[model samples]
Target: MGSLRINKVKYNGDKYYFESPVFTENVILIEGDNGTGKTTFCNLIYYGLGGRVKEFLKEEARTHKEIVNDTNNYVDLYISINTENYHLRRFIGDNDITVSPFTISDVEPPTPNEIETNLVNLDGVELLPVNRSFGNRIFSDWVLEKLNISVIELYQGYSTFKVNFTELFRLIYHDQQPNPELIYKQIDTKSNYISDSELLRKAIFEQLIGKSSSEYYDAIVEAKKAEKEKLLAKHFLDEFEPIIAHLRGAEKVINKPFLMTELEQKEMQLEKLHYSREAFKNNRTANTTIDIALDDSKSIIISDEIGLSESKEKLLSLFDEKSKLFFLKENTAKEITQVIKVIHAHDQLNLFSADTCPYCLTKVERVSGHCVCGAEIDEQQYERFFYTSQEYKEILKSKTKTVSTIELAIKGCEEDITSVNSDIEQLTNNIQNAKKKLRSILDSIDQPIDIETLNNIDDKILSIREQISLLNQKIELENKYEKLSSEYEVKRKAHQSAELIMQGLEVKAKQEIVTKVNDFSDVYNLLMTETLEDCRSARISLDTYLPVINDGEYKEASSGVSIRLMYYLTLLTLSLEDENVPFPHFLLIDTPETAGIELSNLKNCLDKFSNLQSISNDYQVIITTGLSKYPESLANNRVIYLPNKANALLKTKSQSQPL
Candidate 1:
């Protein structure tokens, strides 16, 4: 990753120019009193590096024309990434900015005329225009590419869902405002990019430390292999076991290759039996006395049977219609009763009003000795009162008409049902008489061999043939089971090896993070000399990245700034030295004096940061705090200090006017 170093910060006002400290060391302190634009200074640094201007600050500036008492002001940041240095300028009220191909020495203070212009461009400048599309794609894309950070996909193919430069800065900057207990709350702001926060954090951590994209990918591969093997094993058992079991009960070798030949021979025998039965029926069946009896019965009653079927269908139709009418009448009666009750209740409630208002529970008084609220002695005079009764009467009349129509339909359905029933009874009697005559004729004559007896014998032969075919299928299934079982065992062993490998990789990553946390804890104790008893067992939470002391979050501590100082310092220090961390190694902490840390403890915190600066020249650490909050230890480290509100961050009107 490329190094980000702020060479200089220049603020241009209409009548004056304000400049920040010149680039000197890795660790710099901006000491000031409250309302000294300490947070504003930090936010400018953040915004210059493409970090989001917090919603609260933007809203404030929107409501109030001037921000931090600066009107029509813009800032210029001279920064260096790795070996290259560039001057980035952004004007107020515009989403566009220009970066010039120049050094910090080349960027002089802007003239009064230049400050009045909108987005003043220098020679050989590159316009970094802001995109209003999803994820601010073009802006973030250019920034991340310049920082030498990879443009990795969080959810592949969804261009908007990717890790952004703003999120990376969240880890590097801690504003003056105290965040929630979560250490990663800096990136908790909602955005179109980074839909899954937890996954994005994990990806960021991996990218920083040079780890693979996902540890679960290997586990997923192993699980899928195991699942396929399981299906193979189950298929053989399900398809073949029942067939084998049935064959074994009949004392057959199902797996025998010759079983199909035996089944074919039985099928041929069954076909011959069917042919024999058909020949027997043709030689002796219709010549019998029962055939003659059946013919006579059919001729006499066939027409009457057809009439009976039609009458039965008509009766069913009439019954279905009657049932629908009956249900309709019942529901209509209930609805009419409900409407009547509602009308009666409404009429009773409107009878007369007491000398009071029901809503307010207050005594009612007539305006100029008359009912001004429209309560009348005669309801006929009230249009609303008269309309309610008229509407109810109309509704009742409509319901009564509906009820009369249903009753008339029901009566017609009943009459039709009676007529159909009479026809059905007469037809049924005629058909029964014809069947009795046929029975009498058959009883008089006898037949020796019947067609039923032949059919029974043929059915038995067919059943035996079917059993033989089933046994052959069982034999084939038994052979398949043996083959798949061996394959399943081989696949199961491979799955087990993959699971062990996945577990080993996870443990290695966890141990590396744990070691970094131990180093952080040591630094924290070095800074906090007057430590609370509860912080004795403080450790950084791997999940939330917050301080966990005695199984509780360190954020809940009485001294808020002290805990915040410890957290930021520990993370910065650990990231600086840890080879696995891909941290940019840049930290901008707004205030470390809030929540009332002792002056001695605050001095120790600054001294600790100063000491860490000697470890490497690769990173920068900037801190802002109140002047009286620190001891003499931070005197040399302080860059700008505000003594009072008059000489605060913003220039007063007296200082800017004609000076």
Candidate 2:
């Protein structure tokens, strides 16, 4: 990773102007008492380096609109990343971003300022705009590109998650804001809802230690996604299987009103066919054997008995009339039953106890003809005319008579139909005999079958064909449903396999990362002061990635701030020496001495910063603190000193500037 070192910061415009001393040493401390713009100065360097400050410092920026003297005021940061110097400039109250290469003339602003045609000239400096819609990604992208840092990718939820250098700055720059509960990944401004906090903490640790593999995690996530889709598709099939089966065999035309017209036409045609069959049977009775020659010739008898055609017609008409009588007989029987029930109920009502009214439950004199409630005594007697047994008996008798008459009429019609049938049988026998004789007389003659028989055979064939067509349609639908079901099952199993592979990779990756974290925790303990010697055996919590001292969390310890410094410094120190750990090789810790600690322990903490050169040859550590708090040993490391808030790094319009 490319190393970043902030050299100096300059603010000029309107009525405010101030300049910070050049940062030369590897470990530079900005010392000042409280409210002396110490925090503000550190934050300016953080913001100038494209470090994300909105999440933790948005409220501070909003409250202090006069951070500069005027809205058009500007702050410039002269910094070096990987030995290349650059000046990053920004309008205090605007969205303008500009960067230029370092020049001798750029060391400081001129005494008499020169007016600009636009906000700032882009002749030499590169103008970088903050693209808010894309997460202000443009500025971070440019910084990372210059540093030669590749974009990192990891799996979060169902998507491939991404993080740029701007996010990494949150981990590197420890601001003045105190958050005892959180020690790592405090800035949650990104999409944090999708991943587990514990799992992501481990994942970040893995990434820094060079144990993370984007391809491996992404494959696992993709497989999980496929599995979910397959499961959904399978469930869809299971839910609709019954419906599909019903649809396959369903007779879609059964309830159609349009089919009713066709049914009526078929009924009429069937009736006509029946009439034609009867006519044909009657016509077959004709004597066609008269032409046969006989040995004793006698006049053929022409007796006039009832003609087969007329008898058949009379039988057919009687059958039609009998059907009506049968319906009337059934109707009359129902009416008779209803009337009988009514009469029985009336008789039961008439037998109610003599001197009491059932509805009012009141007593009555047998001969008084009235109840106490004004209800008529013997009320049944007055209502007898409406539902009298005699009237009921009359209606029953009338219905019974009508039923009997209809039955007799139906029986008479049935008798006539039976007699006609017997005569038709006889006529059929006579025709068969006549046909035999005619065949004998015309032994060499050819004969044809009846037209009605041929037409009946054709109609039967058409009906059978229609049934076959319906059966074929049902079979087609069944095949279609089966094919769909098979495809769903195949895809479901494929998704399951992918999910298994993803889970295996995750388990393997976790094992490798835990080993490295244990090693780093040991180094962290060594860097702590002797005061924490008893608890120096503390390790990074595998779950939270925070320091765990003596089986207890470091955040809960009395020297939480000091422990945090050990954790941050150790991580930064490891990043410089170990090729496995990826870090910016830069640190901006606000205050470590503010925590109540012994003077010797405080010196040990400051010495840790000074002692980093032995472990790593390259790194920058910047810390802000009060002058009176830190040990005298750090006096040589003090890069900037602010006596009070009035003469802080950022001079307001009211403060006077030195000549």
Candidate 3:
């Protein structure tokens, strides 16, 4: 639906320059003889738009060595995309192109002369690099964006590749290469990132007809991402399934509440065991008389323990205060050193000549105590403005005094810490002694239960506690497994939904392509019948989008050149007729008469090409052919005429003629 029209093409070199006449017609013809740079003109247009020209220049070196050797040679293509003017410039043997917006004082579309004079002063120019490196801004993507076409990714093998503008232009540009059996240009698969396969060809065709939209590709990408996430979740679950099973077997519980209940029960059992052991000792001792002594010993232990805790806390507080004082003292010392250095720098500056002002480099005069600038030079005020050496010394002395004070404080704090440590040690010994006395008082009584029975109870209690801890751990793992399972299900459903939406879009796109292809075939068959000598029938294959002539494949056709020409014309005609087709409404056919077609059939093809203007005047087709081969009736379409190789499309300063 987008429109691209080349208004002018200018070729500049160190010693010569050539500019094409402003293209004001839909069908522009470049009629030139052999070896007259007709193909060079076409290649310049391609190169100016950021197409590769290294291989092209290498092949044409013998014929166009002068233009190649001129290091300052570059081509500028002035074009309008959807009524917005732009200028694209690319030098020979360069991998990048400079694109600038073409604007001239209130002109909707500036003339080529205005562009040439004002292009250098224009703003918003961008340099687009052409390469296949990942994460780089590519030139083709910019062209596609300007053409209002969405770049979509196509799956190739295990990787995905977006269709570049070069790939799309191959279908639009019908070169003079002899391999007419190939529908598209022969892609060098080794160097090219995208392979020349059925998938690519179909994708190109689908894009041209507006089938492969960005929305469709977005859905596909989302579906793939969701599927990947779902698989990751499943993998995690599979890897941890054994661990979950092991936890379940060890805990014998599935939930947190059950584990909590078991833990509480074990704790209660432990408390009961302690109480029973104490009661049994108490009953054996009949210790009502010693109860008071026991109470006093317990009180003493409690009091000593509290005192020990308080002393430890005090020691920690003193240590913290000492650490803070050390940090503050170190920082203050650094500040004093920095101030002294500043004072020394200021003293050094005073050694400079005092007759001239350092800032203004002018003579200085003092009247009384005032400076040359009429500012009072009070010594006390000057000291306030800048740090004086004596003042800095005083500051350093003060900082030293403060450091001494902090040292005293730290010493005091260390003494207090040592005192607290002594208190803590004494309190700990007193508590231990109290506990020993209480134990002896109990041991003096007769034993109510044997030691082996108490040991058995303690072992059972420890086993129950261990079981409770294991149950808690298992409960946490089970909860995690449940959460992961829920996540997996959600991802799986999302992926499935995305897949369905993608499939639906695919079906709708296929239907649209089918309708467009049928329309394309109508024009193609008509052109083939009129242009071919013995053409029985011609139709584009639905699957491959290639022409099939006389019930045979493209390669099987008797005249491949005729089929190729008709194929290009058919696309042009379809684009003009259908507004939905995403073609740029532009075609570049370079020397189509190379493959030796009959003169009558060639003229028929030319007539079909000129007839496109009747459908719509919104398209531009630039075709190169020999002057003698073109019919005389369509002479108005001839925009450029090259008499011979002497007046080629590109000429050097030594040459006197013009194109």
- Global lDDT scores for all candidate models: 0.62, 0.62, 0.74
- Show model 1 residue runs off by greater than 4 Å: 15-17, 54-65, 68-72, 104-124, 129-137, 156-160, 178-180, 185-189, 192-196, 201-534, 553-556, 652-659
What is the alpha-carbon lDDT of model 1 when measured against the actual structure? 0.62
Clashes within 3 Å, all models in order: 2, 0, 0
Give all TM-scores, in the order shown: 0.49, 0.52, 0.63
lDDT of 1 by residue, 1-659 (tens): 55677877766544445577676778778877787678767867776665556431445534212443444455668877767777665654445555554532434544334443422223344546554454454556666667666666554332335566666665567665554344453653566555446666655554444333234333534555565676777676667667667656867444455666667777777788777765555323345456766887887699888888888888888899899999999999787766655543333233333444556545566443244475445433533433343356458568978999999999999988888888888888888999898775555454345558777877878787777767556655655666666666766676677667757755765676566556666766654434443455566556745566656643343355566666666666666676445566678888766555667666666666766756677888888888666656556777777766666665643474111
Q: Against the true structure, candidate 2 has what lDDT? A: 0.62
Which number leads on lDDT? 3
Candidate 1 vs candidate 3: the TM-score winner is 3
Which residue pairs does candidate 1 place in steric collision? 208-582, 254-475
Model 1, C-alpha of 38: deviation from truth (Å): 1.3
Residue 391 C-alpha lDDT in model 3: 48
* Model 3 clashes, total count: 0
